[model samples]
Target: MRKILVVGAGQSGLQLALGLQAHGYEVTLMSNRTADEIRYGRVMSTQCMFHTALQHERDLGLNFWESQAPRMAGIGVSVSGPGAERLVDWVGRLDGYAQSVDQRVKMAGWLDTFAQRGGQLVIHGAAVSDLDYFARVYDLVLVAAGKGELVSMFARDAARSPFTRPQRSLAAAYVHGLGPRPEHPDTEVARCNLVPGVGELLVTSTLTTSGRADLLFWEGVPGGPVDVFQGVTDPAEHLALTLDLMERFVPWEHARTSRVELTDAGGVLVGRYTPVVRQPVAHLPGGGLAFGVADVVVTNDPLTGQGANTASKCAAAYLRAILDHGDAEFDEAWMRRTFERFWAQTAGPATKWTNVMLGEPPEHVLTLIGAAGALPRVADRFANGFDDPADFENYFFEAEKTEAYLSEVAGG
Candidate 1:
């Protein structure tokens, strides 16, 4: 049996460890916190898994909260115009529904599930020096943890990474009492509101540790008026600031948040990270090599809301690569090739889309979003791109292509 050490208990690490265990491999997972600790800890991310990413979990029998989570049927986009006016508003349908299960709920449950399967779980913080020793015992040592000393092991790929600093200051609050959107009172979808120079506000219903809740996320352009979360540690203050931004920029969204209250003391979060792509293989001091996975290798801005989606696909891809290798040496060469294959298929497209969205929308991109308001055909395709971003390559980048495609839509 191939012994593998997966350091990190996140979406990618846990999924890969569980998948390997199901196949009868010896897998040991090292996490800084236990299941209970994570469940009671502060919220981690604002994630909604679309169809393709969700299927990866379903295939592994890891969709424990599927039925309880909110069904985000589609995506609604509202661009804030001059003072409470919506310059453009439209809801695009997704072929298959998307769902958001709070990481506190999903990760905590997954941690317990992994242990119940007889997989070895170590509760400890891993470091570079620790990996040097771990490298001697396991057939493979994979870094699933995206932060701390482990992340520094993988060097940044400068050629692939564009920004050296965070583009947006992020703040999220998970709470109860949010009223339903009157426009789609009967439907549940992620409503993305753009306030131009201010930033973006994304609201979605999710299943949390306590039960059903809503996530109010603000992605503010750094140094801008919307970047107001700095120095605000109190949860009430954080939420109040979030509401104020909504009222001033997107009253339509604020109307739904009037009755909002935090689900728990740990329901609010604030942080930011620069978008980057790192070298896939990390070299150990003892002549050993470790492989990077998911966010560890390619960290994109959450502007596109693809963090968890990318992690799910990355875990699945690495599992296949490892399984197909049989007893072959999991050497540096194999690791590089495996990550590159996944980068092309999933990471590349997501990173490209996210980086593009982090910047001001190009004239062609703006035109595409406007056209979607009047054209369901265009709207559906744009919304569905969140599920499979590769489709955007055909019409998203070049202005000429977008114009040509819209012209065809008119004629058709």
Candidate 2:
């Protein structure tokens, strides 16, 4: 069995480690926190895993909460009007459902699961010196950690990463007692409320540590009015600010949030980060090579809701490459080539789509979304594009092509 040391315990790290273990490879997974600590920790990320990413989990028997978690059958887009008007409101069915399981809940469960299954796990904070020492012992050392002293080792790919600063201030809170959209009371769905100059709000249903709950997340344009959560450390205060903004800008959404409150004292989180893409391989002081995975290589803003999905896909891709390279040296060339293939096939489209959405969307893009309000086919196609973002490249980016595609859909 090939020996592998996978650092970090987030979506990508755990997934890759579990996958390799199942394949008879000797894998040691390292996590910075214990399962209990993560379980009770602050809410970390907002995710709505579309069909493909979810399948990667199910195939590994890692989807323990599927039936319990709310099935996101569709995605709705609401463009807020000045004050209370909803200028454009439409929801479209996804070809296959999506789901969000809180990372706090997920990572904790996966950690325990890995240990129960007899996989080697080290609950230690792996620094560069530690990883450099392990380099000689393991066949491969994969750095899957998204943050910390480790991630900075990977040099920024300046050409690939366009943003020098965070585009949005991110605030999120999980709560129970949040009501469903009155328009679609029976069906569970994820909603994106867009306020032209103020950034966007994403309301997603997720399974939390206590039980099923709703996640209200804001991606506020920096220095804009919505970017107001700087030092409010109290969870109650954070939630109040979230609801207050919702009432002012997206009253239609706020109307149902009367009963919403924090799921825990640590339920609310506030932070911001630049969307970046870094070189795939990092060199250590001892001449050891560490292969970067997922967010370590490519980080996109949450505006597109692709972070967890991209991580899932990246882990799978790296797993496939590692399996194919049986007993071969995991040289720098091999690492670069593996990442290049994944970038071209999967991450590139997701990154390009997200980067495009972060700026003032092109006129063609707005026209396409507006048309979806009237055309079910257009809406469904647009909704499914979140599952397979490459589809957008075919019909979304160009005005002339978008018109032709819409005409085709309308005629058909």
Query: Which prediction has the highest lDDT against the true structure?
Result: 1
Query: What TM-score does prediction 2 earn?
Result: 0.99
Query: Per-residue lDDT for 223-325 in model 1, tens only?
Result: 9998889889999999999999888899988888768899999999899888999999999999888999999999998988899999999999999999999
TM-score of each: 0.99, 0.99
Alpha-carbon runs more than 4 Å astray in model 1: none
**Model 1 worst lDDT window (10 residues):** 75-84
RMSD of 2: 0.9
